[model samples]
Target chain A: MTSSPEIAMPAADPKDPYAMPALMPSSADRAIRSFDYADFDIPTRKQEDFRYTPVERVEEFFQPFASSDDVTATVGMIDGSALPDTVTVRTASKEETGVPAVGEPADRIEAIEWAAAPSELVIDIRADTPTPVLVDVSGHGLDLAALHIVIVARPHVRADVVIEHTGSARLAEGVEVTAMQGSELSVTSVQEWNDDSKHVGGHRLRIGAEATLRHSVVTLGGDVVRLRMDQDFDGPHAKSDMLGIYFVGAGKHYEHRTMVVHNHPECMSRVIYKGALSGEHAHSTWVGNALIEPTAPGTDSYELNRNLVLTKGAIADSEPNLEIENGNIVGAGHASSVGRFDEEQLFYMESRGVPERQARKLVVHGFFKELVDQVGIPQIDDRIMATLDARLDESVAAPIAEKADDGTANNNENYAHNQEEN
Target chain B: MSTLEIKDLRASVETKEGRKQILNGVNLTIESNTTHAIMGPNGSGKSTLAYTLAGHPKYQVDGGEVLLDGQNLLEMTPDERARAGLFLAMQYPVEVPGVSMTNFLRTAVTAVQGKAPSIRTWTKELSEAMERLRMDPKFAQRSVNEGFSGGEKKRAEVLQLELLRPKFAILDETDSGLDVDALRIVSEGVNRAKENTGMGIMMVTHYTRILKYIKPDVVHVFAHGQVVETGGPELADVLEEEGYDKYLPEGTTESALA
Candidate 1:
């Protein structure tokens, strides 16, 4: 093998344009050599799934790096006491009967090596068993380090994978989850990175016969984060639900792209995503594509993307597409909207004595509750609210609070209705 | 006693043919603890009067002043008017998705009360109010006005009236889209509020159906955007029998009844 370059790129200045950390050669050696980065190049336009999202600009920030000791200390932040004692990484050829079988943890989750020893990962969901697992990945100063994790819900089995990312710097995660025949899976990933962290991750999944898969991503923190999720319903009676929610601030770029396919008859897929952006330069993108194969008779699918832009410079782009080639389909449709808070609704609440902050919070909270409630986890629901509250405080909260000192925030009524419609 | 007074009220709404005046020089006064009925034909601006009083944005008040307890009601926003004890039982309530009835009612109650209602206290109060209306408690969990049948939507309006405890309420055709049973239940709910709170009620309607349940002390005949006649409850009987034709000019079917 050619000697790897050890030169490090300049680290991002905390004050100026948020920059990604440099990558080390060791990390580059781990990725699939056959998969060229340019092959998955984000397009400017005309690209079906990347239509609304600015993935190409985001990709310019990515670099390769090796797993560092920074991850060791970061894992301590996660409460892994409830986690299984033994773990093993199960790939296609490394199948072991007794061990839990998973397609593979995405590279993001697998990158977390324990104490210099490679992580012992295992996907042990057995047929007829219904249980969920939490895989936590934490890091510090890892610079554009990448993590990949793969999960497999065996036939007739059920599982859930909860991924929690807490770290700093530029990080990219790749996750692949597969549900086999008659199986079920729910994967929830939460990115609670700091304002300095930049994250670009992709969730790739496939569901089999009579199987169901649900993927939920809650992004409350991150400077620049882009998420690409692709789901394939491969067997009859299979169903998939993809849901996402994000709150972005000024100078933050949050992009989300989703691609779903109903490849077989009697298969159904639904996608719902909602986001809120505030501050002077907050930008967010939402792209949702649902494809129903011509041979896939009786396919049913629905997709909707809703955005709430809270400020003038805050931008949102939504693109929803449906490719229907079959005549025997039950239904196939898509809806997209990029809007601001509803002013009448806001004034309605405010006139009722809810303060400006509380009123905006209620409207935004209500905006996301529809999709958050779909997760069916009350604890996570509460956690999501708390995270949203904190993020709102982090970006817009400061201005609101600062203005409260001068009693100028009360004039928000003027902007209340003005910002309701984009 | 405090009163809700409309002085020379003139309003119009935008239409394809430009602005059309709906309420022209309308005037009325409602005292606290008394019920007033404004009877009119199909196009007599009855609903427009309610919407104007409630501060709906679509109805522009070209001229007039609305006063609540001698305060300028025209100066307040809709919610502010609501907080100041003016409630409008909308002819068609809006369906707000993702906002549960329980939450909306609780918030409105808190706003009207000018402070947060204790959860425990509000729960008991809500249960009592729902029971009085004979409404299933589960209705509170559904989104406000969403997927509700016409009767259910009307009942929900009355439910808000009870919870909000506004001093003055304009019931805009509360009986318009209800069965006999739903009409009775809704009127009973309003009756209870009147008896318990002594709140002033302004019933605006085309048919005389709801007056039977909640009798009006005074009835005004609305024609050509103005209160052309005012009398005791007997006027409602007279209008019901005459069908507004005797008071209307010939070849003016659109403007006279409207």
Candidate 2:
């Protein structure tokens, strides 16, 4: 547990070094990505951010007029609060554009999003109240699309949000979250894109004085997806808890890079992410970086990443980095591990008369159980489990025991691809 | 009578010191519906026999033939042998995390019996078996042998023996780590298994205490990895009073407890 600071909160500085910088379009990103989207060099493998990802894949979404002509993503409230919706969740108005979340786009593709998207959407939850919001994006066919969302949780309020992406489309999106003082906010972002969908997004959350934020990212289905989660502490005693769970199947790539910047005194952060990969050419990468600034005294933060490999061909590259600029800080640590399924566990099951294949499936199922349960949403958790089971079934899809015409064999093909729409 | 014959059985284990011969040219026969008590001192290969018969990967059988009815037990995998009606109550039962006892037993019963047990009948059978073994009903849903006490592990082993209903059951030190009350309860489960299913049992123990609860038709005194003495039920009483010193070689360091 992170303790609250006993010292008084630092007064707002007249010349706040961390204050908003006045600049050209180069100012805000999560949208800052490409002030010069025109000259934004196609990031090669040399770029640290695009090294693990196939850098060439961004060309499809970079073309102008990428917004879907027919498909319209909608936002719905599922929590049944009956609070009679207050803020404007979404509007097609082109004139409703607002401020971008934070600093300039840290990567090239994010710069592409600024050059693409058609309409601008800003979601503002009235200060000092609780609200639940869900973002549903459904795509059809091959087309370029972009979404930019800015969410503000005013002081003393709690906000819970869920963002889901599905269907076939190339998506470049940016999300910025402003958590005001004494506010509590939790956002669960799920990416269940189709087999051909490609997506990349920059999600940045900035915490205010004495505020807390809980952020979770779950990536299950996608051809190529990368999510960069960036967190900044604006005032003292702000805390952040981050969690993630992902599964990558054959011919798919998923990468999650997260950074927690502790710039205020007495701020704390913790991150835990677990992922699994299966099938040939399955690839997943996780990078966690924690940096404590010089003036940030009494700061404590730690991050951990674990990858479970189910098949020989699958690959997971994990890197956890911790940089404490201020030695006066309390503590900072990070850990990353990649492991294969335990063969001894399988043998124990087989010794009890379970066939080898079934035993293997059981061991993998148990491997992901604890993390899946932590996602906290029963509906989404069940879907993720079903998807994971379908993914594992592909490896053992070979016929068992010569059962002919076996409707069971077809049932084992892995997925129904039930596209959820309401 | 159904005979499970062991002919010229020879086995060795890979110890840190290299392959050490444990069961060398030992032979025994078990007929259905009878209990055979095999008493041996420590390091006499009693536990090795149980593991070898159950197809554990550790012990290597150099030259042997174990025949159950007309099938060869030595040729079958552990799971195959289990499906062919063999049960081993291990000295140290393994812990299988995330596999509940109810699920594990149900799967084994389905594989062995070639069909899933009816739900109501399985529930009744499982509850009755647990009650007879004095195990809490909650234990049925717990991961197999995980976090169980010594006595609880022993009872769980007996519970499997009752439900699996194998043709030949090997009780390997089932009496070892158990209190008197637990010993009686476990023995009662074994007795019920024999009475209801007519299953043959090979009871291996260093003490004669288990024999007091579940009477044996015959008792064999084991020494040097082979049976050196055999007699009727009275032999157990004799060994309990006199020990196995007469059967062991002179200057043998192992205590003659059997």
Candidate 3:
């Protein structure tokens, strides 16, 4: 075990014996939530949630405006089949949607979106699903758009849902999920938007007794994309696995934040997020917050965030915060890392006759293999890998080609020497 | 037959103190099908020579010319050197996470051969090679060298050597951490590769125990970054009995022996 530096504590004041201690609030407790747009102020860098984000790029989504009708969402099966009888998709007013709000909007953008969203798209699953539900969301132009989706998994129902985003738009979106008792539900949200687009999303989940929820987020394209996920346990013996994968290219920013609250006994949660950045001004950030409440016992929770920086001008920030009020709980831990490619690993592969390009690709693929496998959709998995490979090749090949040109010029003298020996 | 020639090779490594020369004007030549043992004490540049031959970025070549069959090996990149029929079985093989042994080996073979091997033949060949080395078949599915035992790592290195079939192979202290049984198993794998491909071998080690199993046709005693003595297999026996003390400079301190 590694030893950590000791933290100095402030001495208690003797003047006021009954004075409450000035303790810093937990991240979850510090977050502000509201359902009304007027209740939220415009976010800035001063806010902890917006500290790492390029707030100016997504400011358009922060204001209350009528959503553009250009945005459209279509629901279909992953295998191109008709919707099964067990599942139904319909639009309803927010007040009459039948599914209670898991949590209020956590930020200005979400609040603005909640107020402007015309209606909620509801997908209700009553039984086991034969195929994954795919929702393709597209924006036609650079206009402001809002989306709200509610996914309900009835008792003992098992289903998979996918939300795919594409096209150019300044968008604000909210996704709410409720896994009823004994149900197993998996949801994946993929953002592959146009390079000129910006997006802000808030995803809220409530897990019921003995229910399981697998939530994944994959962000690949966009000038700026920030997603916030909040998970709360509503009953005992619930399990939540949150996974995220992202790749930020040149002049792009992608940020993901997750908050898991354990309010029931025998609850388990695992958060794993991995990302890679390349090229000038490529940046990515991950912030994971896990809170184990005093009322919760026998809770098993851990969060991990890892980032790989593939170029000189790229940057990655990873932060993991855990707040445990019940020491008697099973366990709670968090770990994070932001680093570049391992030179030794590269050398090992190159020594085995793998070219530098291929070696780097293999290393990156290996780095993300575990988390990508957790996505569990072969088509999406393959798409993510291919996109990663193409981006890596473009970013890695340019510098090597330039270096090779320089090498040829510098080694001209060496070539003459070789000719002499030959 | 192919020949690997090292002429007046001088190299240095950056230490905390500054640039320190490791291989000072070293010279040697080995022909295909020959097994040459390079015996040296710790810090005597045995591993440096191996890594330099394989183009490790840590060791900078100050002045040298390494010719493999009249082609300058020093001018080629590490991967190019491998494709040019050279291999190095590192002492501490790297643990590459998430890259399965099967994937790594297949990619390597494809790069070296300039073509991807047929799936049917490649799978059969890989399993056959693993079986010969007494390696569990599951290792093919596991990440390359990750969570492998010391003995397993060494066997994996030789497994690559047998499969890659390069013109020359450098074993950098391949027997250091192996037991008697593991050493023999690893040695047999090396011998089988030599017999099948007639590939030359440059085995670097500090001890002579491995010589008993994989007999060296020639032995060179290295000290102070240079080859001080060269002889036949009998030289290994002499070093085994006397140790590297006689090879050190006069009055060299014990700490400097390493």
Between candidates 1 and 2, the one scoring higher on TM-score is 1
lDDT of 3 at B231: 99
- Which regions of candidate 1 fall more than 4 Å away from where they truly are? A1-34, A38-51, A55-57, A61-80, A85-132, A139-142, A233-236, A278-282, A294-298, A309-314, A325-330, A339-363, A389-422, B10-22, B246-250, B254-258
Model 3 per-residue lDDT tens digits across residues A1-422: 44455955554565653463444454556677899877777889998788998888888887788988868999989888999999999999999998788889988888998998899999999999958999989978877889999999998999999999999877888999999998999999999998998888899999999999999999988889999999998899999999999999989999999999999999999999988888878888889888888778888898888777777677787777777777767778776776667778888888989998899899998988878899887768888888778877877876742221222111111101010100
Cα lDDT tens digits, model 1, B1-258, are 568889999999999999999999988999989999998877778888987888877789999898888889888867678778888887777766777888878877776787879989989999888887878898899887789999998998898888877789899989988999999999999998988789999999888878889999999988778898999998888776667886677865422221
Per-residue lDDT for B48-149 in model 2, tens only? 888888787778999979999989999988878888888888777877666678888888778778889999999999998898887899998888788999
Q: Which of candidates 1 and 3 is the stronger one according to TM-score? A: 3
Where's the lowest-lDDT run of ten residues in candidate 1 chain A?
A413-422
**Alpha carbon deviation, residue A294, candidate 3 (Å):** 1.0
Residue lDDT tens for model 1, A1-422: 45447965465564553253222222113323223333233345564444555555555333334544444212211234443422223533323334332333222222221111223333545544323466666757744455556677778776566777777756656666778888777888888887787777677788888999888988888788878786776578999999888988887888887877677888888888888888877888877776666557887787777777776666777777565555678777676766665655654454444455666666676777878888755546788888887766665565542221232112222111010100
Interface RMSD (Cα, Å) for model 2: 2.2
